[model samples]
Target: MRQLIVTEFMSLDGVIDSPGGGDHPHAGWTFKDIEMDEAAYEIKGREQEEAGALLIGRVSYDEFAPVWPKMEEFAEYNAMPKYVVSTTLTDPQWHNTTVLRSLDEVAALKRGDGAPLLVHGSANLAQNLAAAGLVDRYHLLIFPILLGGGKRLFAPQDAEKQKLKLVEHATYGNGVQMAVYDVVR
Candidate 1:
């Protein structure tokens, strides 16, 4: 079965919102004050190299479509098959993009034979996948900053207890940490 991996650059206070886009008050916090260290992002490069397909929600797809396709750094993702989950998104403009309307479709995709599906910056979709017990893995790059209040990866009180096993972790000199976890079934 193909694993569904949700990856994100999150703050220490568990804020994943406004990492780049200006939709949130603390937008662009990912790069604004944080020093750009090549070594800190090594895992991101490696994951992009290893990912088979990309999965994202409608909002993320809209936010990334124009920029990521034109950016050279995201060339690997540009070439890979991309899946966007949305009921209203009938047509996706990005190359190799497909729209999956329901969580059931996502589950089916996970069951199909393929390389692991890497999800990036899709907060709502990621939470939904976890709630549905469809998320297989997580690749978190936790920064050393706290933005106080924002959208977090997990809810404050989750009714369903989903256990996770830490399979890999690394703390960089730039105060950035990379953690890889597999959901314990």
Candidate 2:
């Protein structure tokens, strides 16, 4: 079975929305203050390389589709199979893209034999998957700064108390702590 791994860049307070510059007031917060080290880059590259397929939400798909195709660095990711979970996204123009409409479809994808399915920057989708017990693992890069308000990685009101076991952890030179956790089922 393919593991559904959610990798997110979060603040100390657990905010994950718009870490890169976007409509959010606290946009570009991740890079604005701290300098990411080569270790961070290496980790991201390794995650992408290890993934058999990419699963994303509509918001993330819209943000990535236009940019990744034009960048040479993302050639491997562009070539890899992508499944975007969206109720409204009908025609995905990106290469090797499939639009999935329901949680049942995601469940089916997880049951398939493959390398881990990696998810990035899809807070809403991530929350839904976590709540539904579809997410198997979490790879969170926790930055030092705290954003007072923004969309969070885990919303307390929407999510039930799900236990996680720490698998591994590393502190990068850039003050970002990379923590890997397995969902305790």
Candidate 3:
């Protein structure tokens, strides 16, 4: 079975929304604070290379589709197979894109054998996947700053006790912490 890896750029206060210039007031906070070094770029490149597919939400897909395709850095992301979970998203203009309408479909996709399905910046989808015990691993790049009011990675309503085993951790020169956790089932 393919592992569902939830990768997020989050704040110290657990806020995951608008890390890179969005509608949120704390937009571009990650860019403003954390200095991306060669190591960071290498890490991102490694993750992209390892991921066979991307499972993202409609909002994330809409936010990324136009931009990632234009950038040379995200060429791998643009070329990889993508599954966007949205009932309302009809036409996916990006190449190798498919629209998934239900959670059952998502679960089925998880059962298939492949490289890790990397999920990026899809807070709603991530929450659902976590709640369903579908997320196999979490790769969080935590910035030092705290954004008190914003969409969080884990909300209050998500009260289920899901145990996690710390697999790896590292800190960059800019004080950004990279933590990898395995969801203990």
Candidate 4:
């Protein structure tokens, strides 16, 4: 079975909102504010290679479609398959991209034998996948600060529960903590 890994750059308090700038009120708190070393980049590169495909929420898709594809350095990701979960997007401009309207479609994709399908920067989609019990693993890169108020990975929905077992962890030179866990049922 193909694993579905939800990866995100979050704050200490679990805020995964827009970290770029202006797009989210709690923006610019992730890694942009500080300097990172070569180790973090190398680690991230490894994570990118472990996934066969990318799964992104509509918002993240929109944010990335115009940027990552144009960057020459991210050639591998630009060429890799991308699946965007969106309700209204009819046409996806990114090469090797497809739009999925429902969460059930993700389950079918995971049934195939392949490298893990990675979901990045999609808090809402991650929560839905969590609620549906579809996410197999979670790889979070948690930064040091807490953004008091911002988007959260887990939503407030009448006490939902998830059983997660820590599989691996590492601390980068930039004070970024990486945690990988498998979801247990």
Candidate 5:
């Protein structure tokens, strides 16, 4: 079975929104709040090297399409297959992109042969995947700060508890931590 890995940059307070800069007042908090250190992002390079494909929601797809394809750093992702979960998206302009209609389709995708699907910064999509018990692993870079408000990687809601096993972890410069947890099934 193909694995689904959700990756994100989250605050100590669990805020995962606008980490790179956006409309949020605390936009770009990740860099502003923590000192930039190349060592802190080594996991990012490693994960991208290992990821087989990219999976994202409409909002993330929209936000990344124009930017990733243009950047040399994301060449691996640009070449790999990309899936976007959206009922409304008919045509995708990004190269090697496919539009999936629903979470059921996502589940089916997981059943098919492929490398792990790496999900990046899709808050709504990530939450839905978690609620559906579809995420297999998480690659998180938790920064040490409290961004009091914003969308979170995990939200407060009533749902069955899902067990996880910490399979890999590391701490980098500026007090950033990388934890890779696999969902215990």
Candidate 6:
């Protein structure tokens, strides 16, 4: 089975929304709260390079499409295949991206034998995948700050409890915590 990895930028308080920029109340939490050193940025770039493909939710797809394609730093990302999990988006503006219809379709694609799928900054999609037991692993970059009343990774109404085995945890010099976990069932 192909492994599904969900990657997200989260705050210590579990806020995973608007890590870059958005109209949300926590729009600039990541911008104002944390700082990334050259080493840390390089590590993040390396992580993005290792992924075979990127899976994104609609909002994330829209947000990233305009920026990543124009970014020279993300040339690798532009070259790799990108699958967007969206029911509403009929067309995607980004190059090298395709749209998947449903959760079952996503599961089918994952099981059909291909390289690992990396879900980046798509919290809603991540929650759905987590609830459906589709996510095999998680790569989280947890920053040190509390952004109260921001979007959450897994909402409280989601009663599912996912057991995860912590495989690795590394603290960067700039106070960013990186953790890798495999789903334990």
**For residues 1-185, could you state the per-residue lDDT of candidate 2 as single tens digits?**
99999999999999998887676788998888779677865667888789999999998999999998999988878999999999999999999999999989999999999999999899999999998899999999899998888888898595789999999899988888989999999
| Clash number for each model | 0, 0, 1, 0, 0, 0
Name the candidate, 5 or 6, with the larger TM-score value: 5
Worst window of 10 by summed lDDT in candidate 6? 35-44
> What lDDT would each prediction earn against the true structure?
0.90, 0.90, 0.89, 0.83, 0.91, 0.83
TM-score of each: 0.96, 0.96, 0.96, 0.93, 0.96, 0.92
lDDT, candidate 1, 1-185, per-residue tens: 99889999999988899798758788998898588888888888988998899999998999999899999999999999999999999879999999999999999999999888999998889999999989989999899998998888885475488899999999987888999999999
Shift of residue 53 alpha carbon in model 1, Å = 0.8
**Counting only residues 3 or more apart in sequence or on different chains, how many pairs clash (N, Cα, C under 3 Å) in candidate 2?**
0
lDDT of 6 by residue, 55-132 (tens): 999989989998898899888889999999999988787888899989998998789676678898887898888888
After superposition on all CA atoms, how large is the RMSD of candidate 1? Answer: 1.1
Worst 10 residues of 5 by lDDT: 153-162
**Which residue ranges in model 2 land beyond 4 Å of their true spot?**
none
lDDT of 3 by residue, 18-137 (tens): 999889897999887677656654557888999999999999999999898999988888889999999999999999999999878989998999899999999989999888888999
What are the runs in model 1 whose C-alpha is more than 4 Å off?
none
Model 3 clashing residue pairs (backbone)? 21-28
lDDT per residue (tens digit) for residues 1-185 in model 5: 89999999999989899998776789998888799989879888987898888999998888899899999989999999999999999989999999999999999999999788999998999999999989999989999989899899888587678889999998986899989899999
Deviation in Å, model 4, residue 160 alpha carbon: 2.2
